[model samples]
Structures are given as C-alpha cells and as structure tokens.
Target: MVIFGLTAVVVVGGGAFVAKRSYDNSKIVPTPITPEDFGKIALGDLYAPDPKADAYKAAAVTAYKKDKLKNARKGVAALDWIEIKDKGPGGDGFPQANFPPGSNPSPGSNKGVAKTMLSSFGFGAEQWGCLEKLWMKESGWNERAMNRYSGAYGIPQSLPGSKMASAGSDWQTNAATQIKWGLGYIKGRYGTPCGAWGHSQAKGWY
Candidate 1:
C-alpha cells in the first residue's frame, strides 16, 4: 500500500508539471501596453526611468505674477461615461496627461448666459437648443469674432446680421445685434434652423 501511494504521488506530480508546461507553451504573451506604460514611452525612456521619483517634475512655488497671460476657469461637473471615452483610448488618446478630462474648457460656461438669452427670447427647448449649438460653433461665443475675408463679425457670426441695425446699431460689438440677427435669421429661413447652427453641426459651419 505504501509503494502504491508513493507511485500515485509521482504520477500526480508529473501530470501537473506536464499540464503547466503545455499551458505555458500554448499561452500567447500579450504585447498590449497599459496607459502608464504608454505614457512612459511618450516621454522617452530617459526622462522617467524611476517611476517613484518622476524626476522630471515641476517644483511648486507661490506668488506667481506675469505680465502677459491667457487663462481660463474650469468647472467641476460629474462627467458622463462619454467623457471617459474622450480621456481614454476611445478618446483620441488620453487627454494631454496631467490635465484632467472635462477641465473647464473656457473662461466661463455659457450655461447662465444661454439661460438668460433663452428667457429673453422666449425660446423653447428645441429652438434655443439649436441656437446654442450655433454659437458654440460660431465663435465659441467669443463676442469679438472677426472674419478676415467676408468681413463677417461678432459672436453670432452676424455676417450682415449687422443689418440687425433695425434691432439696435451697437451691431459692431453688440451681443444683442448678433443674437438678434441670429434669431431673426433662424426665424426667417429655417424658422429656427439655428441656420448656420444646424449647418455647423452638419458641416461644421455657422
């Protein structure tokens, strides 16, 4: 009985070894890389050899003052799953590293201004919704957009929405003229196409 038990142990051990070897040989080693690994590649092997040190780091300091500068304020919003796609491989490559996704993209969100405009214009969800898309594409609501060629100008790409003179002459830098012409344009032809607004969504114009 002892000899039989010893024999069984050897057989089991041998079987396990064979199975492991076959499994190892059959498995395909994956060359796929993780975001961290890819990021390391991005900087070049020389920059961050020691992950712990992250040797190439910016030292923090206070009282920063500069003469010329451009800046924007970001907002804190719960990102939807779609944002993840934009931040990951699904997004056109992770957002420039360190910079978090959905960082306040502009100096201020247009939400409030848009809301006010909607109320003033008596625009319903669908109509103003179209207007919103138009401005977003026009000048990002710049309020100072100027076209070099056709000489179209202002936030709403007033074109000659400047003709909004009938509304009020401040048409040059007037958000009101721009908005008025934009609204009128939509009402006239598209009757709320967001005219170029819808044009922009379809062909990135307006």
Candidate 2:
C-alpha cells in the first residue's frame, strides 16, 4: 500500500512538471517598447523630416519675396488713358490718324479692318495674332456669320447681333462696324485680345 501511494505522488508531480514546462514553452514574450518604436507607432513616417524639400520650399519663398520687393521698388506706370469718343468714322471715338493711312482693307474682309483698328485700342501686331485666332474660332471672320444654336451673329459673333449697333447703325451688313464693337467688348471684358483668346481656349468660349 505504501509503495502504491509513493508511485501515485511521483506520477502526479511529474505530470504537473510537464504541464508547467509546456505552458512556459507556449507563452508569448513581449518585445521591449523603445522611444523610436513608440514614435513610429504613434506618428508613422511623418516624424521623419525631408531637409532638401524643406530647404527648396524656403528658398522659393525667399526668392518670391525678393522679386516682389524689387517689383515694388520699380514703380509701375499707369495705363494710358483711352477715350472712347464719337468723333471718328461710324461715330466710334477712335481718331482717324490711329488707322494707318492706305489701310483700306478690301470690302467685306474683316481681318484688314481689325488690323487697322488695333492701333486705336492700344494693341500692337502681337495682339492682332490673338484677335485673329479669337475671331476665327468664333465666326471665321465672316461678317454675316451666325450661330444658329446661340443666336450670336456677325464677324464678332455678337449675341443678338444688335449689340454692334452701339458702334454703328450698319452693324448687320458692315464688317467694320462689327469689328469696332467687338474690340470695345474685348477691351471692356478681357483687357486685351490675348486675354480674350486665353479665356476662350480654356473654356471653349470668350
């Protein structure tokens, strides 16, 4: 009987020892949390700084401020006063001398009329290019051109066509009259032909 009791105690103790060993082997040990690891976990890679990109941005800002200061020091001239009078041809105020002598473009050809009129609006040859492109896309320079969908008409494609009457009573039949109104409109709305053309290019209309 005593031998059997001793054998049972040894078996129980051995099973407990084996169970404890298994538990210890299966247990997961936690890794030590370092400061760097905590930073990565909380803020991710955002904690890292890009010195080159920061330097470039700082340089760009400094350059922009310097340029602004230079421009401020170099005072800008006011734009030349433009007077829209009713003394010239078609009762539009632009002076006759503004039109280059012998610039009588062929009747019904709107481009020649526009080129002659550009000087009156303070535009140069460079502006003529932009005006040409703008009108070509709008009406192909055809004085009678009409958009059936939008009801815009004339070489300038003035909406309702009557707006050109502000320049002359012959707005419908006269390319010169239409061109005058168109130039006025461009100056008022866009400041220049290139400005109008740029807007047209971006939005498919001016």
Candidate 3:
C-alpha cells in the first residue's frame, strides 16, 4: 500500500511539472489567438491620431501569421491607414497645403503635374519613367481611384482617404493634393520614385 501511494504521488507530481512548464512557455511566446478573439475582428482603416492603432495591428498580424486569424488584411489595413493619416494637415512635421485663396485650382487632368513634382524632387527622366510606371500600375494617376479590396484611395493610395487632408482640405476633389501626398510618401519611404517602383515590382505592392 505504501509503494502504491508513492507511485501515485510521482505520477501527479510529474503531471504538475509538465503543466507548469507549458504555462511558463506560453508566457514567453505570444498568446495563441482563439476563435473568440477572431470573432471580434471587423477590419477597417483607422485614423492616425489614435496612438494604439499600430500596436494593435502589429499584434493582429502576429496572430494572423500564427494561423489564428482568417486573413492578414486586418494587419495590412492597419499599416496603410497610419501611413496616410500621418500626411494629414498638421501631421507631425509634414507640410500643410495652405494655398492662397483660389491659387489652387481644380485639376482637369493629372497630366504634367506628376512630372513637375518629379523634377522638384531632383529626379530626372529615368526616375520619372519609373514613377510613371509605378503610379500607372497603382492608380493610373487617377486622384479618385480607390482600391475596392483594401479601401485605399487616391493617387498615392492613402488608406482611409481622410489622411490626405494634410496635403489639402480638397483631397477628395483635387489631383494636386493626392500628388503632393504621394510624393511625400515616396520621398520618405523609398528616398526616390525609382526606389518605390522597385519595391512595388518585387513585393507586388509598394
């Protein structure tokens, strides 16, 4: 009877040790995403002023990669929204579009506008050609173009649309607003239009 009691204690102690080890390992790694958490998700572009959005997105993507979520669009949308929102008027060190009253006219076409901005960026024809191709593929230089799948809108394809308001109040209707934002994005992210084009080519999206 004493031997049997000793054997039962060993079994229980071994089980307890294994359970404790699993709990410790879980704390070191990311918490496994569960179906309940997945059900709470409904993806949409968030405005940038919300400081917690990036961290949320990062966690969501991490969970998605772990096969806990249905799609990574939730994560991609998170990144796109913030990038565009940072260009908004008064967005932390970015230029605000403060055109003299009526100095900025509505664009009838985006023709020549992109080229002018390209030159201003110190990019020559080689860079211009790449940018032209890149934008053409992304939105055909259409200020009003919107991606139905990702909710990205405008020439630079700023997610959530409102983020372009930093470039101008007339973001929705103005070609120049979109171009300005797009140029800023290229300069910041890739250092040059060709660089962005290269990334787009390799990644299937810039």
Candidate 4:
C-alpha cells in the first residue's frame, strides 16, 4: 500500500509539471509599442491628423503658386512693344500721289491712299506689296468695282457693296473710305494684309 500511494503521487506530480510547461510555452509575448503608436492605438484609430504636417503641405502649395505667378509676371514684362508707323500719303511710299477727296481717282491714286493708311492699322511698308497684289486681283483698286455674280464690291470685294457704308456715306465713290473699310476688314479677319494675301493665294479668295 505504501508503494502504490508513492507511485500515484509521482504520476500526479509528473502530469502537473507537463501541464505547467505547456501553459508557459503557449503564453503570448507582447510587442513593444512606440510612443506615437501607443497614442494612435489608445485613440482606437491608426491614422491621426498631424497639424504640423498639414500646415507644411499648405505652405508648400502657397509657395508653389506664388512662384508660378512671379514667373508669369516676368514673362509678361519681357514682351516687346509693337511699333506703328506714320500716317498720310506721300514720302517714298508706293503709288505716291496727293488726291483731293472730291477728285476723280484711279487705281494708282487708290494705292497711294492705302499705303499711307497702312500704318494706322499697324502694318509696315513691307506689307504694301501683298496688299497691292491682293486688291489688284480682287478689284484692281477700283472704288466702284463690283462682282456681278457674287455681288461683292469695292477694293476689298466685300460680298455686299453696302458693307462699305460703315466707313463713310460716300463709300460708293470715295476711294479713301473704301480703303479704310477694306483695311479694317482685313485686320479683323486675317490679322494683316500679308495674311489676307496668303489666304487669297491658296483659296482663290480672301
């Protein structure tokens, strides 16, 4: 009986030791938490708003916009001014002649008026050759020139003759008035006389 009791006590002690060892081995070790991570975890959110970071991002955006605006202003300041030449007929310009307003005029006289007026619309004498050629093909610089089929009229060959009335009441008879309307039309549509000439050359019409 003494041996049996001793054996039972040993068996129970061995089982207790195995159970303790298994419990120790199964225990989880916690990872060390950084101060920042602990704060986030304590707040129950992984992503916390950082005021300093937000301010830095906002400041960087504002600085980029200011730099972009400064460069734009510099670009604007670097642009060159366009020079406009003198007005009125005569002095080494093409088809040079002085014609009184009421005088009967020819194509050459009409060209004289056009050359003087070119500068008013910011064109140089270099543009006159193209202007002359364009009008010569369109209406031969005639104030009363008319297209029977298209109803285009005057030096610029405006589709309707009445369109020249915007320049003056005597658009039908006055070469200067017709030239003014024509130049204004050319400027609005083609930017320059040469541009109009180029379009006319390519398309057979300006």
Q: What RMSD does model 4 have?
A: 41.0
> Over 4 Å off in model 2, which ranges?
1-108
Model 1: per-residue lDDT, tens digit, 42-120?
4433121222111101000000001011111233342111111121111112111222444423313443455466645
Window of ten residues with lowest summed lDDT in model 3: 79-88
Tens digit of per-residue lDDT, candidate 4, span 1-206:
54344334334443342344235433524344467654543442322233332332233233333444555777844211111112111111112133345655489888999999999989999999999999987777776665322335578765434445557545556688889888887887788999989987875566
List the global CA lDDT of all models.
0.39, 0.56, 0.53, 0.57
Best first by lDDT, ranked: 4, 2, 3, 1
Worst 10 residues of 2 by lDDT: 79-88
The predicted structure with the larger TM-score, 2 or 4, is 4
Could you give me the TM-score of model 3 versus the true structure? 0.49
lDDT tens per residue, model 2, 112-166: 8899999998888889889999888777776656543233566766644555656
Indicate the worst ten consecutive residues by lDDT in candidate 4.
Answer: 79-88
Comparing 1 and 4 by TM-score, which wins?
Answer: 4
Give Cα distance to truth, residue 48, candidate 3, Å.
11
Could you give candidate 3's per-residue lDDT for residues 26-128 as a string of tens digits? Answer: 3543344345433322121122233232222232223223332323535533222212221223222233334344433323357478877777766777787
